[model samples]
Target: MTGWLPVAPCTPDGCARHTGAVRAPLPAALLLLSGCALVLLGVACIPLVRLLGAGPRRRLTRCWARAVPQAFGVRVIVRPHLPDGAPDGVELVVANHISWLDIPLVASVLPGRMVAKREIRCWPLLGPLAARGGTLFIDRDRLRALPAAVRDIATTLRSGSRVVVFPEGSTWCGRGGGVFRPAVFQAAIDAGATVRPVRITYRTDPHGSGLAAGAVAFVGADPLAASLWRVVRAAGLTAHVDVLAPIPADGEDGRRALARRARAAVLGPGDLLQARQTAVASDRANRPAESVHH
Candidate 1:
């Protein structure tokens, strides 16, 4: 990452811990193939999927999303803790970034428009799928283009569309995650939408061990192929998505404040404490270097 782009501290060698049992090479290969086949199948059904009504399309998309991860031998569990009676409007779903798989995990429950980098619109099969799914792309190369992009997102929200964004910007290795970028929250504020913070956590011991499955994170320079293989072979891998209660964007707070509000909601108490501890440890480790430089 360069310039104003966010960079995660997670690196492949340092953070991708391959925890849990291993799958045989043949079975893992088969699982990867099955996942690819599902992708192709989804691509083939694009037209039919587009023709369906919004509600039905979302339902079908949710099922297909769930199936994709299952094909990759990963189980996804959704804890839907929506408030009893939250007013319905445009919803801005913000989630922490973990891996490419986070996309499908989020789509499974909240099938909505995803915000992605502009380059993703040109990829192979996945590119077309995202375009068909009504993705909002951001041109990261041009800071000047952000206002226009924000306006476009606000317009989409005003149309009663749900916009999903990984506010962390870059993928983290599921430890002490990065802070949420505040720019996107402006869209929610402008559109008077409710900001919903969804937390995505990876666990290697799916027997409810709750271990961090950072092994599957596509952080730093890890190639996409390597991440795919790791995910396929990682036995007992499970993804937990906790959909926290929504925070109304109607408050007169600025985007930064809203970002903090949403991020706090996503991290919850446990993660917030972990993050603080991680920061403290990191500071202590760097203290020697700081003294040398001084």
Candidate 2:
């Protein structure tokens, strides 16, 4: 709920042209059903995870994550530029928040447990599915819960498992988002884990208008159902994820510094340039038409 809420401006006729282009009811229904089936399949496999251990559980969860986006007609493109000789031990994967799709987008390629807000735990079927997938929920509204959440994340990393955290704390339009919160970086420091910064941006097909046509962003106050509908109905949506070089959580860098560096990497040149281009295009599209004289 950090970025602009209203849809971008349309033409003089007052039609929400851009919005209308992305709303396909039939496709939405089909995509929703497909996503539900995938979730149900994951739910059914939950019992086996306990018996088989982390390896099987992670693999199953990864498959479910990868399929969810495909169900919604969203493709994930990974651009990894990891440093050579980086530690392959436990990792803390941090990325920018864009939409609920972000969960699966990140999970699909980089398999790991996620650190999500506590509200996700009460979202009906999704709640149980997330819990089963090894998600660690935190009550962001409560300051007292910070230590406990950090401890849980550290413990997970110390166990040689990767943990994903959205340091931005809230969702935003893919063009740009809020600053990264530094509290979670303590987990990486505590566990002596490497912090991997991943940048995720959304774009539409070349034949379409641009990223806005894809309508994958879940910003502002839009309800979950409505957002999901827009995503399912969108055409040629693609999520571009860039996994930057990993930063060491050594004594030289503290939690605050680590968070700053992570944010800088995630909001690198490519991301900033794209954001500016999107903003400029939006401005041009929203401009009023000049009246012609005889």
TM-score per prediction, in order, is 0.89, 0.79
- Model 2, 226-292: lDDT tens digits are 6677777876777777778899988477887887788779888666665445445443442321100
Q: Assess candidate 2 and give its lDDT.
A: 0.68
Q: What is the per-residue lDDT of model 1 for residues 1-294, given as tens digits with 9 covering 90 to 100?
A: 223255667788887768668899999999999998998899889899889876677778888988998999998888873332233348999998878888898888777788898767886667888887778887776666767878888998999988888977677787776666677888889999989899888887555676765667888888777888989988888889898888988758888798888878887877887765544543343322100000
Query: Which candidate achieves the best TM-score against the true structure?
Result: 1
Q: How many backbone clashes are present in model 2?
A: 0
Q: lDDT values of the candidates?
A: 0.77, 0.68
Candidate 2 to native Cα RMSD, angstroms: 9.6
TM-score of 1: 0.89
Model 1 scores a C-alpha lDDT of 0.77
Model 1, C-alpha of 113: deviation from truth (Å): 0.5
Clashing pairs in 1: none
Most accurate candidate by lDDT: 1
Candidate 1: lDDT of 69? Answer: 89
